[model samples]
Target: MEMSIKSDAVPASDKGFYKLSWTQRIGFGSGDLAQNLIYQTISMYLLFFYTNVYGLDPGVAAIMFLIVRIVDVIWDPLVGTFVDKHDPKLGKYRAYLILGGVPLTGFAILCFWNGFSGSLLYAYITYVGLSMCYTLVNVPYGALNASLTRDTNEITILTSVRMFMANVGGLAVGMGLPIVVKLFDPSETSDLSSSDSAWFITMTIYGLVGLALLIFCFTQCRERVVMDKSETENVKVSDLWLEFVRNKPLRILAFFFITAFAMMAIGNSAGAYYINYNLSGTAGELSIFMGLGSIPAFIFMPMIPAIKRKVGKKGMFYIFLITAIIGMAMLYVISMVDSLKEHMMLVYIAQFVKSTGVIVATGYMWALVPEVISYGEYTHGRRISGIVNALTGIFYKAGMALGGVVPGLVLAFVDFNKDAAQQTPFAQQGILWLVAVIPAILLLLAMFIISKYDLDDERIDQINKEIEMKHNNQ
Candidate 1:
């Protein structure tokens, strides 16, 4: 069975799988880079900021994270449906880069503010607003990937570029942020918890840079494969669920998103605690350790297209997922050994291995999104990219919610004392589990979820061609 639709005028260049120039590719990729700057800071540091620096209770922060994500569940589809149904002068997807980004930057900086320190109301207002604004930009930016072109190979390259740029942002936040905070500390203290002003300054810089990159992205990306205005008028919030129910590949990708992001979120949120308490490492060592997590993306992301071609998607996922699990196990074992516990080099090596596997496997999953979007267009006669991305966003945020909840719960369970200079032995062990075992388990589950994704490159190419043919006929 197939769905059909009458088409409005689509350009000759847009009637078939179009090729994007390097400039266009980089421009589009920058949006992810921009988002990573704002969002990764939150993901990696927000909980620590809340409890250690801003002085919120771990349990309270956990509840806040869950609440924020629940709000996203309601908000994502509305933004998705609205973006699909409305055509703005700036561009369908590109417009949001500025429309949503400017405010996103403001709220992102505010999330780190110490003005109303320990105020739950302040945290809720700032974090919730930041998240909604992020959805406004992110759902559209994801849809923009599918709007670019239909060539499977091109999409692979584009996804690689995007992930590479994203990791660059991760590096800045992961490695550079602690150093930046130290530089800004008035007391010459390396500890971020000692100075709220430093956190605010660091985020302000990151947020402003992100805003500039978003503007650049808006200027560069052109929406090529969008639903015509008339056709879009029929779009409804219900289509988000409708597409999910009928789209098999979307289902597989959505589940994979949940597990994959959960792994990253858990590991990232636990990193500071792992370094500060479990490893007894200094802030500099923690920066280096976290920095290593993103560094491997540079080495591995560029090779993704060639690797995928050689190994096949499922094979690539299997190899990398297993590699990540092995790395996680190494981390757990090394932490337990007194001799290895003294060796920061060993920890860096383990982190490099684990991050390599996790980064490449998860990074390449984004390329699959366009394939699933094409599948939906083929089966449903509508290219509702925004709706599809919104569905994926919900699952990803759910995974993020788990990331936020698990670490906080673990800390609370172990009686982690924010005021203590050193964590209790049991608390240290809980941090170890958060950083290693928990994330490793999530990675294993992610492998199983991705194995269910059946859309190979060849099949997707065939679907794209068929969809293009239908558009050309109309």
Candidate 2:
């Protein structure tokens, strides 16, 4: 496919690269925060809630998680095609923040409601709707990253701010959520894990907050680098697959997204189970353990540009991905030692190490999305950001599917008894593997996949400059 650039189409100030204000950066970042509030909560706690509080079997919950992702496989490209093909007055990409956010909030709230608890029909309907609505927002929000600017340094900063805010949401869900649920439970002595009402109320509060942030994001972001109406009219849903086939950088990034997100999803989903069953920890400990996962992002994310400058993208991935594997190995060894099992401090330290590695490595991968989008635009002469993001979304969700499926299947295989005060030794071992070994394996794969990504910062910058010059000559 070819794109014709009309002489009148380029705005006088449209130089292909744009600089954004602090407010614009933060505004774009808040969209991720909003998403983490709704979706990250589901990723981290939904399985636990389904199995222990809502009374579904672990296997059943796993199937439900897989099914929702399967739906995403069908839904994401459609949303991508739709967004790319039409430019709404609100904004081509930004419009979906509100359009999708409203229903997403509703479905998110309903996903936690226990009124029809354990009903497969209720679970499927709510989860499916929630996942679809998420796609509407996520594909466009991702495209918005490429739309903002072509400055690699600026995109890095924007990605840093975005990940920082996103981690704040993760910290809230990881740390504050357990505390909030416990406080809201009617039974003062009973664990919040078993209380359906606590989950319902907590989700209601989180869902509303996510909606408000979505509005904030919509107000703050503006789309500058977009295809004109005539150019967009030629976009088709098949472009999602076509772009994946033709774009080498996108393929590598897409596979990397899958591995990175799968690693995160598996680790996050298994954390509560790991703490509760494997470590015999209390709610407060679980909160701290999970919260540690995000805390390091604040410290490390700001330094990403500096890190990449020194190490280059591939070198940075190699360092951090290996660090993550080492941390996971430490956790496994610590868990297996009976003497170390009672030492909570050692467990906390290991968790901190593991989280630090995971947080920084996975956090930086998002910055790659816009780079790949630029590569595609350079090669194809049209910026099909939505289609590219859709492809990445599919792979990431595929990773998430493995995350959801692996833990539940492992639990079921080990004969994990959710209601038991203490699990069988085999069950504890399975949880340990989920927490450490499996995620470690995935990280190693991530390291390999990222090695295949050839668009380093200098190369991408050159491509952006060339694309800009082409536009100028048009």
Candidate 3:
């Protein structure tokens, strides 16, 4: 089959390599910012909310997390194929920014509502619905990057801006969430579990704001580098698996996504527990500690282009991954030493170091997804961006599944108690394992997985040029 480019669809200037304006880039990035605002809240706090506020046992919640991800394994690829084959009247990929974002916001808010309180069925419905809606938005939004342009530098810049905006949402949820929930909660108690109403209201506000951002993103993004209608019509769900089987870089990148996301999810879910039990910290302190996890983005994300140019991609990953491990070691040592426990500054410093590594290493990995998509297009003569993103989504969610399962199972083994004001030493140790030791191991594995990815910036650029030449000759 021959792939065709719509001669009249893109401007002459955008023919060979498309370049977007500042407005367009930010508009495109707002889609990520929006998803983070809604989903990051779920990732970082939903597990905590289920056990503490929503009144589920840690083991039960862990099982539910696993189930939800299992559902996604079936759901994500279907959403991907649907997005690739259909070009909506509003926009090809961007239409989902509204179509999916609407229900996603509703389910996100409902996921925090306590009317059902301890009802496991209600929990399954809302959580499953929320996860499905998120797939609808996430898979297409990911595809929007490759749909925007073929320029390698432009895609890099787009990924940088997207990650920066995404981290901003992370900071808001991490730092701002507890404080906002506090203001909305009527009780004076420091425990987050007692404030169900506050959690619901806070999610409502976040969900609405997230939906608005998705709309703005819908307005800003246009599909410029998509498959032709004829090519797209032949896309299928099996193609997702076929692509994974054939695409070596995609397979390697898929493993990296699992390790990277698993690392983040495990660490993020454990932060509140660590601060509350391990450190005997207050809500204010929890906010600062969690906020610091994303604060490094402001400092280091801007330096990504320069960092990549200086160290090259692999070298940068090595540096940051090592930096994260060193930070985790500091935390473990600080917790064990009697003299060091009292110095909050030392803890914060360790967090900053650890976060710098994680934020840079995990953040830049998004840039690689587009490269793998280009690789698929180069090999198969079709740009099935949605299918590629879906495949990556499955692996990343598989990583998240591990993230969701480990902490809960470990907590259950140690007899974690939500009703008690403080945990046993064994439980505290489990939280530490979740926060420091386990995540550090995953980062090590991520470093190894990324090493196997063979697509360099130069190689991807060559692929894009060759595809363009084939289209022109047609």
lDDT (tens digit, per residue) of candidate 3 on 5-58: 445555534555788899998998888989999877988899899998888999
Regions of candidate 2 where Cα sits further than 4 Å from its true position:
1-13, 190-192
Query: What lDDT score goes with residue 423 in model 2?
Result: 93
- Candidate 3, overall lDDT? 0.90
The TM-score measured for candidate 3 stands at 0.97
Instruction: Single out the weakest 10-residue window by summed lDDT for candidate 3.
Output: 1-10
- The TM-score values for the models, in the order shown, are 0.97, 0.96, 0.97
| Number of clashes recorded per candidate | 0, 0, 0
Model 2 / residue 195 / CA error / Å = 1.1
Q: Once model 1 is optimally superposed onto the true structure by TM-score, how far is the C-alpha of residue 374 displaced, in angstroms?
A: 0.7
Q: Worst 10-residue stretch by lDDT in candidate 1? A: 1-10
- Model 1, 1-474: lDDT tens per residue? 123222454543555567889998899889999999988898899999999888899999999999999999999999999999998889999999999999999999999999998899999999999999999999999999999888788899999999999999999989989888888888885454458898999999999999999999998997888888888889999998899999988999999999998889999999988888787677799899989989999899999988998999999999999999999999999999989989999999999999999999999999988888889889978888999999999999999999999899989999999888788889989999999999998987888888888888878877887787777677
Instruction: Report the Cα lDDT for candidate 2.
Output: 0.88
CA deviation > 4 Å runs, candidate 1: 1-14
lDDT of 2 by residue, 1-474 (tens): 013233476642476667889999999999999999987898899999999888899999888889889999999999889999998889999999999999999999999999997899999999999999999999999999989888889899999999999999999999989998998887764343668888899999999999999999999998888887888888998898789888998999889889888889989999999888888788889888888888989899899999989988888888888888888888899999999878888887888888888887888888999988889888888899899889999999999899889899999999999889899999999998899998999888888888888887888878887887776777
